[model samples]
Target chain A: MDFNPIWLTLKLACITTLLLLVIGLPVAWWLSKGRSFFKIIIEAIVTMPLVLPPSVLGFYLLLAFSPQHGAGKWLQQTFNIQFVFSFQGLVLASVIYSMPFMLGPIKSALQQLPVSLSQASYSLGKSRWQTFIRVLLPNIKPSLLTAAVLTFAHTLGEFGVVLMIGGNIPNVTRVASIAVYDAVEQMDYHAANVYSFILFAITFVLVTGVFIFNKYQLKSPLE
Target chain B: MISINIEKKIKTYQGQRILKVSGEFKSESITKIHGPSGAGKSTFLKVIAGFIQPEQGNITVNNNAWLDTVSKISLSPQKRMAGFVFQDYALFPNMTVKEHLEYATADNEWIKHLLEIGKLETLTTHKPQYLSGGQQQRLAILRALATKPQVLLMDEPFSALDPENKLALITELKLIFQELKTTVFIVSHNPQELDGIAADGAILSELYINN
Candidate 1:
C-alpha cells in the first residue's frame, strides 16, 4: 500500500509536461521554419526516444549525466544538482521520452499557416521574432493545445525512463509505474489496479479530447 | 520614389525553368509583370520581395541593395517595404479585418479615405477564409494598400472576380492611386490583362507579360 510512489508519479508527470512544452515549442518552431537539413536532423533526434525502447534512452541519459561526463561534474559543482537518480533526472528523461508527442502537432500546425501571413507582417516592418509572437503564435492555437496535452498524457505513461533514472526510491524517485511493478512483484493486485486505472483514465481523456477538437474546432484558418 | 533594377535573374525547380525578366521597375507607376502559367511571374515577384534569391543577378530599389550577388547584400522582406498581395488572398486567418488593419499601423485618415475609395467600409471584421472569392480578393487588395508601401506588388489580384467586379476593383484601385500617388507592381496572365491595360493613371514602366 505505498501511496507515495503514486503521488510522486502524478507530480513528476505534471512538472515534466510543463518543461516539455517550454522546450518543445522552440524546437518545433525551429524545425518548422529551418531548411530541410536542419529540420530533418532535429526531427530525427526528437523522435529518437520514441523509436528505441525506453530503456535504451534511459541508459544513455544516465551515462550522459553521470560523474564520468564533464556536464555531470559541472552540474554538480555549479548547482549541487545530481541527476543520476533524481526527480530532475526523471524530467530530463521525460523530455526526450515525450518530445514527438509535443513536436509533431506543433510542426503540423505551423505548416498549415499561409506563407503570406508572415510576409504581410514582415512587410509591415515587424521583426521575425515579433512576427512569430504576434502573427504565428496566435494562428496555431490548436497545435499548442495539442502539444501540451499530448505531452502531459505521454509523460504520465512513462515507465522505463523513470525506472532507469528514478531507481524506484519511494517518495523521492519511485513513481506510479514503478509502484505498479512493485505491487505486481509483491502479488498485491489491488494497489497496482489503483495506479493503472488513473493512468488509463488520464490518457483516455487526453486522446479523446484531441479527437473532438480536431473534428469540431480545427477547420483550418488557411482556406 | 521607388526604383527596382534586376539583372539576368534565373531560377530552376526540378529541371523546370520559369521567369526570366531583365528590366528595371520605376516608382509612381503600376508596372504589370504579365506572363502565362509557369512564366516565373510569381517567382520574379518573390525574388524582389526578398523571399527568393536569384541564381545570378543584382536587384536594387531606390539605390538600396535589395539583392546583390556580388557583395552578397540581401535584405529581409520586413526591411524592404515591398508590399505583397498573394494570389490566393493570403490573409491572417487568426485575425479579424480590424486587427489586420490595425496590426500594420496602416490605420490613418488616409485609410478612411481609401475605405471610401476601395469601398471596403462594411467588411471590416471578416476574415479571408470566411469571405467569398471576390470578397477575399477585395480584402487582399485592401491589406496591401493598407501598408502604403512605396511599391505595392500583387500576384493575379483580380483573378477571382467576374468581369464587372474585376473592372470595378481595377477602376477603384486606379482612382485610389491617382490620389495617393504610390508606385504599384502587378502580375496578370490573360483575361486579367484587360484590366491592367485600363489603368490609365499609372505610367507603364516595363512591358511584355504573357497572355
Candidate 2:
C-alpha cells in the first residue's frame, strides 16, 4: 500500500496542531478572561469555521491565496510565497478549519477556573506571561491535550477544504482523505479501504486516548 | 505605610451604590477589617493589590504612588508585589504543595521555612485535592508568605482552621509578620481569630457597607 498520503497527513496534522497551540492559547485565554467589546465578535469569527461549509472557506481562501488578487498579490510581490495548492496553503486552511476544535475546549477550561489562581500568581509578583505559562497553562493540561488531539484528528479527516485548496497534489497535498477519494474514483476499493482504515484508526486512537487521559487527569487532580 | 483614597461604583443585586473609602494603613502592622457581606472588603484589598480599578483613587505605598487616576498612572499587579491569601484558598490544583511555594519563590530555604510554618513539610508532595480544608488554607497562607512580600493581604485567612490550628498558625504568622516587618490587611468574618495579632482598637468595621 502507498503510504505517501499517510505520512503527508500526519505531517500536516503535526504542523497544524503545533501552530494552533501557539495561536489558540492566547486567543482562548482572551476569549475566556478578557473584557472587551470585540470579544463576542472575535469568538464568532473563530467559530465560523465550525458552522461554515469547508468549500466556502476554501473558495475564499483560494481567492485570497491567488497571486493575482489582494492578499495573494501582496504576498507574491512582497515575499514571493504562493499559498494556493501548496503545503503552506493546506496548513493555513487546516488551522482555520480546526480552530474551534482547538479553542473551544481551552476557553471553556480557562473560564471554569477560579479567577483567584491567576490573581494569586500575580500577587506573587508573576507577570501575565508568567502566570499564563507557569500557573494557567499547567492547570489546564487536560484542555490543552484535548485541543491538540481534536485538532490533529479533525485535520486528518479534512476533505472539502483540502480538495478545494490542495487539489490532490501527491506527496505535497494529497492527504489520506483526498487519497481515499482518489482511490474510490479509480475503482480501487482495496487502496481506498487501506486509506480509510488508517485514517479511522488514527482518529479513533487519538479520541480514545484523550478520553482515557481525561479520566486519569480527573481522578488525579485537575480541578 | 499604605495610604489609599478611592471611590468605586459597585453594582449589586440590590442596586448601584458608591463605595467610598479612605485610609492610611500603618507599616509593619496588622489591620483587621470585618464588615457585613457585600461591603466591598474583598474589593478594597483587590484595589490595593491593583487587581481592581477604582474610579477615583490614589494608592501610595511608602510614598510611591501605585495608582493615581488623575495622572492615569496605574501599576499592574505584578509590580505591586503584595502577597494575598484568598478566602477560597486558590491553590493551583496541578501543583504539589511544594511546587506552590516554588512557583512563588526560588528560595529553597524560604520554601522550607514556609512549609515548616504551615506544618506542610510532610505533605509537600501532595496536591491540593488531597489536602484537607485546613491544610489547604495553611498552604494558601504559606504560599502567600513564600514571596516574603512587604505587604500581605488576607481574606478570612483562618476560616477553615480548627481553633487549635488557628491559634498556632496565628502565633506563627505574628512572628513571621514581625520578622518580615510586613504591613498586613486581614478581612475576617471571625474577629476573635485576630485578637492579639491585629492592632489594638483598630478593628475597622463596615468601612465600605454599601447600604
Candidate 3:
C-alpha cells in the first residue's frame, strides 16, 4: 500500500529519460555519420547494454562506485557525493541501462533522412549546427518521441540493475520494480501484485501511445 | 570568374570512376552541364557547392581561393554560400513554401519576389507534400533564390514541369538571373531543356563529363 516506491520510480524514470535525451542526441548524430573504426567501437560500447545482462553492468558499476576504491573513492572525496545505494546511483544506472532504447531509433531515423536535406541547408549559408537543429531535428520528431517513450518504459521496468547497485533503501533507491521484489520476499502477494500491475499498465500505455502517434504522424502532411 | 580544376573518385554501378572537370565559368552567365547517367553531373554540382571534397582541386571564385588542396584551404559549405536546388527538391517536409524561402533569407521583399517568380505566391502556406511535383520544383528554385546567392546550382530543375510551364518559368528566370547577376550551373539530361533561356543572349557555356 506504500506509494513511496511508485513515486521514486517515476522520478528516476523522468530524470534518466531527460538526461539521456540531452546526451543521446549528439552521440546518435555523431554515430549516424559515415563509418569509421573509432565510431564503430564507440557505438558498440553504447549498444552493449542491450545485449549484456543488466546484472553484469550493475556489478561493474557497483565496483566502480563502491566508495571504497577506484572512481567511487575519488568522486566521494573530491565532490562529497556517493553514487552507491543512492538516488543518484539509480538515475545513473537507469540512464546506462536504457541508453540503447533512447539512441537506436534516433540514430536510424537520422541516417534514413535524405542527405540532401543537410546539403540544401548548408548551401543556404546555414552552419552545421544550425542545419542540425533547424532542419535535421525537426524532420525526426516521431523518432524522437519514440526514443523518449521507449527509454522511459525501459527504465520503469529495470529491476536487475536497480537491485544490484541501488539496494532496497525506502525512498532513496527502492523503485517500483525493486519494491515488487521486496514485497514478494516478505510473502506480501497483494502488495507485489499492485506494484506489478501498475508498472505493466504504465508501460503498456506508453508503448501503445508511441504506435498510435507514429501512425497519425504518417497521415499528417507536416512531419 | 569561377575557375575549377578538380578530380574526384566516385562510385557508380559499374565501379569506381574518376570525375575530372576543368572549366572557367564567367560571372553572371548560365552554364548547362550535360552528361550521361552516372557521369558525375550531380557530383560536380555538389563539389562546387562544397558538399563533396575532391581528392585534388582548386576553386577560385572572383580571385578568392574557395578551395586549394595544396594549401589545405577548403572553405566549408557555409562559407561557399552557393544556393542549390536538389534534383529531388529536398524541400523540408515540416516547412511551408513561404517558410522555406524565409529560412534562407530575412528580406521580405526578396521572398515575395521569389514566390512571384516561381508562381508559388498562392501556395505559400502549403508544405512540400501538399504541392504537386512541378510546384515543389518551383519552390526549390525559389528557396534557393531567396538567398540571392552569387552562384546557383540546379540539378534537373525542370524535369517535372510541362512545356508551357517550363517556358514561362524560364522566361521569368532569365530576367531574375540577370537582375541578381547570379552565375548558374544547371544539370540536365535533356539537351534542349533550357534552349530558350540559352538563346536569349546569356553566355550559355556547355560542359560535358563522360565516364
Candidate 1 i-RMS (Å)? 3.1
DockQ (C-alpha based) per candidate is 0.58, 0.68, 0.76
How much lDDT does candidate 2 score? 0.89
Mind giving the per-residue lDDT tens digits that candidate 2 earns over A10-123? Answer: 999999999999999999998998667789888999899999999999999998888888998898899998888899999999999999999999999999999999999999
**Tens digit of lDDT per residue, candidate 2, span B48-83?**
888999999899998988999999999999998899
For all predictions, the C-alpha RMSD in Å is 2.9, 2.4, 1.3
Whose lDDT is higher: candidate 2's or candidate 3's?
A: 3
* Fnat by candidate, in order: 0.75, 0.91, 0.93
**Candidate 3 lDDT, B53-139, residue by residue in tens:** 999999998898989999998998888889899999999988999999989999999888888888888998988999999999999
- Judging by DockQ, tell me the better candidate of 1 and 3: 3
TM-score of each: 0.90, 0.94, 0.98
The better candidate by DockQ, 2 or 3, is 3
**Candidate number achieving the greatest DockQ relative to the actual structure:** 3
Q: Candidate 2 chain B, which ten residues in sequence have the lowest lDDT sum?
A: B201-210
Better of 1 and 3 by TM-score: 3
